[model samples]
Target: MIILSVESSCDETSVAITKDGKEVLSNIVLSQIDIHKVFGGVVPEVASRQHVEHMTQVFSEAILKANITIEEIDFVAVTQGPGLIGALLVGINAAVAFAYSHDKPIMGVNHLFGHIYASQIENEMKFPAVALLVSGGHTELLYIKDHYQIEQLGSTLDDAVGEAYDKVARSLGLPYPGGPVVDKLAHTGKDTYKLPRPYLNKEEFNFSFSGLKSAVINLVHNAEQRNEKIDVANMCASFQESVTDVLVDKTKRCAAKYNVKQIIVAGGVAANKGLREKLAEQIKDIEIIIPSIKYCTDQAAMIGIAAYYQNKIEPAKKDYFIKGDSTLDINQS
Candidate 1:
């Protein structure tokens, strides 16, 4: 199936064309990272405006890059929810127009499912797997029984991991999107601060990063108050260590408990070097699948991949392609 997909969940305005959900022909993403950097984070109104400005251009580019006409696209797939409502509507409205004009079927895909199914682009997914989804707005552990069956194992009680990373980065006077910067600096320094690994003592799959973020903020604030120098690199390293340790430990335990065939680490934070390396070193038995960095973040390709599978299980109807749902549940499908 040739799937044309739209994704304007947050600061990214993306469109993609995929063949059979496994091969991505073109995935065009226009990110507003630089624009939002000045504000320290994404501004909803700004993101919505940017999406409106670029949605048509992105769609045209995606089609051109794919070397396919709109008629060749079997169906249209778009991110339905779990994102900024205004940003999502831009993509959803565009998709609706495109679908209606082309007389093609459209489907609203869950953003979280897109993250998990993104692994299909690089590797074939195995059933009965556990997925660790860590991103800016969400942190969740999910049990995947098959392509059509996924259950939420646990999720963040407070701020998501990526949120914690960004908050910690701001406290340290780092850039807006802090995950990559923090991850990079972490490699240059040692884990000297010895930050706490929140909820590591608990056996549940739940996570909590609010406390960890606060600890880092407090440490930085205290050092500044005393006029003491703060080792930014070391602090990044320590913070990354604390976060990765708990995530890896809980994920491993969840996989073992379920006796899953493989583990899929999805979401934006899956691009973190620390989490990738630790998961590789620690989990020796089961296979671990992490998509390439491009697929790890928000993109239309993953949404297309997810929509392909959904179409296989149940074909989409025009009525199903309605307005966006900001809080669409992962297990809704």
Candidate 2:
């Protein structure tokens, strides 16, 4: 089977061509991080407009790179929900139009599932796995009972880890997309700030980054008010320590509690050097699956793999189109 995938769930406009579920033919992503950098976050309208401009060229590039014809594509898939509505619509309407034009089967994929499939680039998913989705907009703990069955055990009660990273980085005068930036700077200094790790001791898998966020914000503001010279590198180190500690602790607890066979890490923050190192140290007994950095961030190849798996459980059709759905319950195996 051949699938062409589109992902416009955020500032990145991505397109991919994949065969069956595992073989990636072509994956092209045009990032608007440069455009959104000045704002310190994604702007929905700017993202939508950029998608409109790049979507066409992305599709063409992906197809040519894949060395395939439109007729060779047996299915079209797109991320359908839990994202900025305008950004989501750009991809959805594009998929709807492509499906109409090509008379192909259309699949509406959940964005979280796309993150899960990023692990597929490395290896096939094992049953009874755990997925940690840490992205700009979300931080979710998912229990994968099987290939098609996914259950959300817990998630962020307030700001996501990536959001917190960007905000904290901004407070420290770091650039936008601060997760990697902080990760790099953190290596140069010690964790001297003693940042808080909120809700780590909580009895559930749920996360609470808002408290951690506020704690860091207060510290940063206080340093400025006192006319104190803040150690930027140490601040990054301290912030990342708190974030990594919370994530690793919770994930390890969940892995032990559920007896899961594997843990797959996904999303943009999956590229964090600290998170990866901490996870490696913490998850010694269980299998740890991390995708190639290409798959870690938002891309259509990940969406194509997700659609292939989703199709195994239930087919996505034109009639089931969804947009901006935070409560979407995508069936798992």
Q: Give TM per candidate.
A: 0.98, 0.95
Model 1 TM-score relative to the real fold: 0.98
State the C-alpha lDDT per candidate: 0.93, 0.86
* Candidate RMSDs in order: 1.2, 1.9
After superposing candidate 1, which stretches have Cα over 4 Å from the reference? 323-326
Top candidate, metric lDDT = 1
lDDT of 1 by residue, 1-333 (tens): 899999999999999999997999999999999999999999999999999999999999999999998889999999988899999889999999999988899988999999999999999999999999999999999999999699999999899999999999999999989999999999999999999989745779999999999999999999999999999999999999999999999999999999999999999999999999999999999999999999999999999999999998878777745644526577786
Worst-scoring 10-residue span by lDDT in model 1: 319-328
Give lDDT: candidate 2, residue 3: 92
List the pairs of residues colliding in candidate 2: 148-332, 148-333, 149-332, 149-333, 150-332
